[model samples]
Target chain A: MKTATFLNRDEFLNHWQGHRKLTRRTIEKFPEEEFFTFSIGGMRTFGELVKELLTISVPGLEGIVNKDDKPFSHDIELADKAAALKMWDEQTEQINELYNKISDEELYETFNLFGQYKDQTNNNLMYFHDNEIHHRAQGFVYLRALGIEPPFFWER
Target chain B: MKTATFLNRDEFLNHWQGHRKLTRRTIEKFPEEEFFTFSIGGMRTFGELVKELLTISVPGLEGIVNKDDKPFSHDIELADKAAALKMWDEQTEQINELYNKISDEELYETFNLFGQYKDQTNNNLMYFHDNEIHHRAQGFVYLRALGIEPPFFWER
Candidate 1:
């Protein structure tokens, strides 16, 4: 029996990119000092969360494309919001390039991600979206608490 | 020209239900008192957030299915965690029922959600997923802050 396909490769790319656009705006909304330092209820700062996203997207896609099982790392750092946005823009491009390298057929193939999580390529890809949205939502709450209005969620 | 389909109806339903399952687990992990009263940085309690979810899912879908453009409401209240879970389970079933009433072709039809937000049925459906994941992520932060280990996200 043939497995059902959810999103065609292009659809997935467009959808993921839309989410990235919104998340990028979310990152920009933060003040430099607060972006890295603010937290509510002992949650990590939004910058730390953003760092995890930056670490995941391009690196995770590259791992899938290169068949590398490197350990997960959030070791990268940025000097300020400007540096972080620059890296985000760069990885947005890299994600597109690396994502296209994997054919539609490959989406179903199982692969180990970050030498720890193993799942089909499609699930791993979905996880990328899930992880980013999870952190971005936290950023939303942070913005609200800080008395800043976040960009509309449906804009993406 | 034919528009590209992202997810088939069943695929969308299954993906959505998976999110619902994980969200239910997140609700389950909260202590009854904290679920309603505990919040950080002026964020609403997880219980309030869950009430919003409860309000949106069934009523929103009912709007879609019946072509009823009702105003958005988060007025529904539950007495305890048990009551919330019971409502969630009932809505889970209602979502399945109401979702099936929309054929694959109708997924492209535009509807004004809660008589305010208007978009294609497909996008509105996606918003359901997006909204849940967004709040659930907040719930995750709440859980961590309360020294609770929330369920693994990937389980869904």
Candidate 2:
């Protein structure tokens, strides 16, 4: 039997944070007035999507670290991009905090996410990363539709 | 120094293939006419986006595997969804072939991708995976806007 490791937990965290940084930039590029109202093809406004991200990260990590299960919610009132950016920064710190508390031994444990999705701790973390990338890509399209060039995808 | 390993080379390939499966399903769900035309927020149509993915994966892998750098191009004529899906399946096979050729020793070496964008072989591979996730996410938004429920993001 043989095993290989591409990246450690720390690298995974850094990669996730890189995506977060990119998402924050996407938030900065968005127009404040259109943040809540704009939608193309009936998709949720970027504001709604950003709010959902804000709702998830810290709360999700807290659930994993404290062994608590709570149903998922995306009902945060991010009145404007400024408020959203402020919380985004806060959650970034909270992620760093909660993420470090989970021992490596716990990395593979199955923790019920939002009392719903069940997966290893690592998969849940990947979900957070992937979900942000997914939404941020949509935001890129939204930005493009508004004739704005998004921050380079590779810059992160 | 402490080092931790999360996943091996084979797992990364499997994860990437999972996303491809999901993206194929996305193409299946799209209306035939809209495959080339449907878009939200001035973004490229799902057809156009899919073509770009097609353009990158196999050619990009071939470049890395054979050490041949060709400029990137997405001008392939995919007449319709059927043609596109067929080519996609073919490319998926090609990716498996090309991906396996590169030794683990070469994984961290930088290769000029498409005659531009130099990064570690692993990072380029990640770019392929992340690029697909990014585009597929945009497709997800396009689907929702069309009142179509996309294949579950997690199902892949």
Candidate 3:
């Protein structure tokens, strides 16, 4: 078997797209009320984590596209889920917009992330999807705790 | 002002339990058939991802617990979700087991993770929990695509 790697731009984008779709599904699984409820000490609430999903991408992508690394502040405290949902939708659009703006030459170059960690642009890009994948897993556990069934892992 | 810091053994374990409680919830959300499906190329299906999760921990912890770096080959494969869950439960036990075995000196010293990366045993130990957080996010997206509402994000 050949080495399994994501080398081309389209291939990478497909995975990212799939991830965005999957995260949207995670949002659907929540009742919306408890989606943002805080549980464990120091662990973020579902709503809070979802808020990070909304904020991190736009700013993070804006940073990556401009080659400037800035902190993506996470704010899950909101009066309503609709606003959070709307923000998440807009960021989703921004991710794709800024994403296509990146040049292949820049992809491999190291960029600073939140003033720490010398990050590779490609890896940072992957982190976009990878970070979502990380947080959505927490979403899954929350679903099960509510006795709700989440979607298939690979459906996206 | 407060300090941002790394987790200690007990802190890490609580995080693990918190993650695990959520993971099982995420798994419950998905249909078993698609658990291993990778909607995009180069991305592991959720099933394959689960297997990886099951296998990574013991070797990672054993590296610290036993002072050895073991590869992914072992009697257990993280691929089996139920088995992975079982193994994960077992590994958590093993983590507890190793926790008792390690000296304070060992906990503070650097440990190699199958040549993946090297850090203090404390960090590597925490890596185990970080891994779970990363993958669970994928589960969230999957659930959303299925049009299933997962439980609250903060149930644990």
The prediction achieving the highest lDDT against the true structure is 2
Model 3: residue A85 alpha-carbon error in angstroms: 2.1
Ranking of all predicted structures according to TM-score, beginning with the best and ending with the worst: 2, 1, 3
Candidate 1 C-alpha RMSD relative to the actual structure: 2.8
lDDT of 2 by residue, A1-156 (tens): 224555567767777888899999999999888899988778789999998898888999999999999887898677899999999998888998898888887777888988997988877877787788898998998898787889988777
Give per-residue lDDT, candidate 1, residue B123. Answer: 72
For each candidate in turn, the TM-score is 0.87, 0.91, 0.51
Model 2 steric clash pairs: none
> Per-residue CA lDDT of candidate 2, range B1-156, in tens?
224655567767877888899999999998897888887656789999999999999989889998998898999888999999999999888988888888876786889989897888877887788889999988887887788888888888
User: What's the lDDT for all of these models?
Assistant: 0.83, 0.84, 0.63
Residue-level lDDT tens digits of model 3 in B1-156: 111121234544554676677877777676767776633223456676566676677667676676677555534444545765676677667766766576756766777767656766655554555566666665665565566666565566
| Local accuracy of candidate 3 as per-residue lDDT tens digits, A9-87 | 5545655667677778878777777866733323567787777777767777788777676776775466666776677
Report, for all candidates in order, the number of backbone clashes: 0, 0, 33
Output the better candidate (1/3) by lDDT.
1
Q: Please write out the lDDT profile of model 1 over residues B1-156, one tens digit for every residue.
A: 112333456766887899999999999999888888988668789999999988888888889888999997787758999999999999888998888786656676788988988878777777778889999998988887788888998888
Off by over 4 Å in 3: A1-5, A38-42, B1-156
Considering the two chains of model 1, state its CAPRI-style docking category: acceptable
